[model samples]
Target: MIITKYRFLILSIMILFSVKGQSQDKFKGYFEPAIDLSYQVNPKYGLSFGVENRNVIYSDKNMQYTVKQIDLSHFSEYQWHSKYAFGLGVQYRIEHAFDVDEESELRFQEQIVYTPERSGFETDHRVRIEQRLYASVTKHRFRYQLGYTIPLAQKQANEPYLKFDTESLLEIAKTQKPELEQRLGVGLGWFVSSKTTLQFGVEYQLENYTQQLNHELFLLAELGIEL
Candidate 1:
C-alpha cells in the first residue's frame, strides 16, 4: 500500500509540473484604444476604410522592455441582416518590441567574450509583422476574428552581415522560428445617435516564445457621419 501511495504521489507531482509548464492561452485585463472611419454608400450594402493603432506596454515592472504597434487596418462592411454583419479587411503594421536584454546571451565567435564587445553574435532583437484578419460581428457588438502575421522585416540591436542579403535572412528567420503572432478580441459599444458611436474593447497577442502577455489595451470613441 505504501509503495502504491508513493507511486500515486509521484504521478500527481509530475502531472502538476506538466500542467504548470504548459502556456496559458489567455490575456490579462487592460485598456486598448482604437479608432476608425466608415462611409455608408447605401442601407443594405456599404463600404468603409480606416486605420487602427495599438500601443502595448508590458505590465511587468520593466521600463526598457515594452512592445508597441502602429498598424493601419482597412475594413469593408456588408450587412447581411439586422442582427449580423461580415467584414473583410487586412492590416499593414509597423511594430517595435523589446528583445532579449543586453547580456542575456553571448558571442558567436567566442563563449566568454561579451557579444557587444566582440561584435560576433547575431542577436536577433527587433521584429515586424504584416497581418491579415477576417472578422464576423454580431448585433450586440461581439466579434470573433482570426489572423496571421507574417514577418516582413527584422533587425538586431547591433549586428551586421556579409556575403548575404540581410533583409532576406530576416524574412527567412520569420518562418523558421514559426511564430503565430495572432490576436483575439471581445468588447462592448454604445450607439448615441445616427452619426456617432462609442466603442471600448480589449485584444490579446498569442506568441510562441516568452510568457503570454496581456499586451495591448484598446479604448476608442469615434464620431462619424454616413456618406
Candidate 2:
C-alpha cells in the first residue's frame, strides 16, 4: 500500500512537471529565503516568529534578481505531538516591483493543525483563516494544506527526510467574485542540530487571474530554529 501511494504521488508530480515544461514562456523563477524561530513556553504552548524574503529572477543564467516581497509574522500556538494544534498570529508584508512604491499589507490569522498516525508516512492537515488589511480593500482568505513527511534515516532530530505538500487558497469574504490560488511543492530536509532544521524545494504555483495559462516556479529555502 505504501509503495502504491508513493508511486501515485510521483506520477502526479511528474504530470504537473510535464505540463509546466510545455509552457515555457509562462514560467518564471522565484527565489525565497525564509527563517523561523520558536520558543516553547510550556508543553502545550509556544511563541513563533518568521521572516521571508522573496525575489523574482528574470534571468537564471545571469542571476538577475529583483525584489519581489518580504513577509514578517509572529504567532502563538498550542499543540501536542501527533495530535492537534491551534495558533493565532499577525503578519506585516511589503510588496515591491521594478518601478513602483512599495505596497504594505497587514493580516490577522488563525490556524489549526492535525496530525494523523500512519505506518509508512506521516501526514498532517492544516487550515488557516486570515483577514487581509490592505490600503484599499479588505479581504478574508482561507487556506488548507495537506502535507506528508517521509523519514529517510535515523529517527533523531539530526537526520534526513523528504516532504511533499499541496495547498489551496480561497477568497471567502468577497464571495461575489472569488479568487483562488494553488501550489504544489516537494522538498528535502535535514536536521542540522537538535534545535535547527533546513529545507530546500521547488514549488509550482498557478494563478487564477491571468487569461493566459502560466505558472510560476519558486526555489524555496526554509530554516527553523527552536529555543
Candidate 3:
C-alpha cells in the first residue's frame, strides 16, 4: 500500500511538471543550496538558523553561471498546541555577494503553521507575512503554502521520504504594482541519521503571473541538522 501511494504521488508530480513546462515559453534556471540547523529549547519552543545561496545557471540574457545572493536567516518558533505553531524570523541577504557592487537587504517575517495528525502521510499548512527592506524601497509580501510528506519505508533509521509543496505569494510595493507568484516543489529526502536529513529537489516558479509572466526553475539541495 505504501509503495502504491508513493508511486501515485510521483506520477502526479511528473504530470504537473510536464503540463507547466509545455505552457511556458521561456524560463530561467537557478541552483539553490542551503544548510539549516535547529535547536530545541524546550518542549514548546525551538530555534533555527540557516544559510542559503542562489546561483543563476541558465538564462537567455546571461548564460554564464553567476552568484546571485546569499542569505543568513534565524527563526524562533513557539508551539501553542500540538498541531499549531507560530514563528518569527529574520533574514539578512547580500545580493551579488561575490561582486564589488553588492547590495544588502533585511527582512522580517511572521508565520503560523498547522500540522494535523495523519497516519500514512504528513501535511502542513503555513501562512506567512514578510517585510523586506532595501536601500531604496520596502516591500511587503504575503504567502501561503501547502506541503505534504510521504514516508516510503517504515519509521526507522535511514528512511526515505517524498515531499511536495505548492505556495502562492503576493508582493506589494510602493513603486510597482502588486505581483503574484506561484511555486511548486517536489523533493526526495533521506533520514541520514537520527538528527540529520538530506534533500534534493526541483522547484518551478511563476512570477508576476497576474501581469507579465516570468518563469523560473530552481534546482535545490539542502541539509538539515538538529542539535
Best by lDDT: 3
Clashes of each: 6, 0, 0
Q: What's each prediction's TM-score?
A: 0.40, 0.87, 0.90
Best-fitting candidate, scored by TM-score:
3
What's the lDDT of the predicted structure labeled candidate 1?
A: 0.36
**Compared with the true structure, what per-residue lDDT tens digits does model 3 show for residues 22-84?**
875567899999999999999999999999999999998577798889999999999999999
Clashing residue pairs, backbone N/CA/C < 3 A, model 2: none
Which residue pairs clash in candidate 3?
none
Evaluate all candidate structures by whole-model CA lDDT and list the values in order: 0.36, 0.83, 0.90
Candidate 1 per-residue C-alpha lDDT over 1-227 given as tens digits, one digit per residue, 9 for 90 to 100: 32352354335434533543473533322334555677777885665555444443434433232344455656555656553455555555454232232111110110011111112222221122223221221111112232111121225322212110011111113224333333433333444455555554444334332433223323333433344
- Scanning candidate 2 in windows of ten residues, the lowest lDDT window is 206-215
- Over 4 Å off in model 2, which ranges? 1-4, 59-63, 80-82, 96-102, 118-120, 155-157, 172-176, 209-212
Model 1 lDDT-worst window of ten: 106-115
Candidate scoring better on lDDT of 1 and 2: 2
Can you write out model 2's per-residue Cα lDDT over 17-106, one digit (the tens) per residue? 888777654667889999999999998899989999988885533567787888999999988564899999999988844336755789
